[model samples]
Target: MHRDLHAVTFDCWGTLIYEPKREQGALARREIFRKCLQQHGVEVTEERASDALREVWLRHWREWQAGISSDATDMAGWGLEAFGIHERAAVERLGCELAEASLEQEVRALDGARETLEQLARREIRRALICDTGYSPGRVVRQLLQREGLLEFLEVLIFSNEAGVPKPNPRIFQAALDPLGVGPEQALHVGDLRRSDIAGAHGMGMRSVRIRWQNDDTSDLPDAHAVVDSHAQLRELLHLDGS
Candidate 1:
């Protein structure tokens, strides 16, 4: 049924990259932000900085659900707002700094990630990346993809922070289509989430593939054109070897 497929778009988190749970990752990020503020001569308590970040994320979560998107530049400014520094220039600079530092943290690509992408490229299938960022900025995510050598394999990239609205919103999905010059019917979308990836693509008339890793549970979700666990299974299903 996907005879007309000309493009493939992927969800980043839980799909291309595996993020380990670091009990102290947020704490570490907060410390980095705190230090950056100190270097700028603005002092903020660690506890206050952490709380501000949590609050901003919670607010952004609600906003993202309502179809609003934001970026780390804003978070960097908002986080420093806890210390009463309202200069836009200073806040934006600090946000960039925070994101750059956070990129040095650990983020591992999923098994078969590089191999699968390389094969996709070898076969000349156009690919894109769409993701909603968490504590780390989209800037950090892009750098991670580059670090993992996955950046070159993608043709389009859209992150929630940069998109200003999260998935399930058709705008960002449309953005993915722009570079490829493909309509929804000419593309397939692969992602782990029902609401964001699958549903968003479905809503736009794009074929959707639901992907699940070993630890993912998506049994209760609506149907997809294909359900796959690993890149090998996906390659088999798509017959990417040119069979």
Candidate 2:
């Protein structure tokens, strides 16, 4: 155990919990968009809706790579414009429905995640989450985390959509670290992505551990200080197993 460790921050999607039915969630969101467009008296096939959704996702990816973030509302507006339907009410409704669609899918916490957090809490090490939001914004993510019983352990939750910036950017990391009253060197960050999570935490002068149970990112970016395949290994690495 690192005697100087004061806090630990996590990346939500692949680190703590994962959407087990991601493809199903995507299909559901596409169907929801189709129905929303139909309600606006605009006829669109599922193929067209899928294309629009794909485009919006691509746009989001490009923006994310450039250190910009967009939320479900922005996605909704872009999607509506793609279908040539820009009714204000329709955009709002579609945004809301899209945001809530993930709730219909199964989201499960990684193995040993709760136990790790509980141990950390017991040891008085603060916890926080710095997640990059996609279709689901910060508010939706909070509901998912709460449902998984992980929210109570996290004192600070910083979503890219709410922060107006994504990981690999120093500001987002600071957003979590500042409120927790911990500096970069005193905290550790665990996440899946090398480009975003690992790089971001290191950039802030914090130790980073890359968890690969959910996603094994193969990017050429610098590797984290340590890599673990599961939260079980993470517990061992952090010396939370009471060795």
Candidate with maximal lDDT: 2
Candidate 2 has an lDDT of 0.92
Q: lDDT for every model? A: 0.79, 0.92
- Top candidate (TM-score): 2
Q: Candidate 1 lDDT, tens digit per residue, 1-243?
A: 447768889999788886585545677778878787787797878777788778877876786777777666777766777677788888777767666755666778888777777777777778999898765677688888988889999989998877877899999899989988999998899888887788899999999887897445455757678889897777777777453
Ten-residue region with minimum lDDT total, candidate 1: 214-223
TM-score of each model, paired residue for residue: 0.84, 0.97
43: Cα error in model 2, Å: 1.9
Stretches of model 2 off by over 4 angstroms after superposition:
none
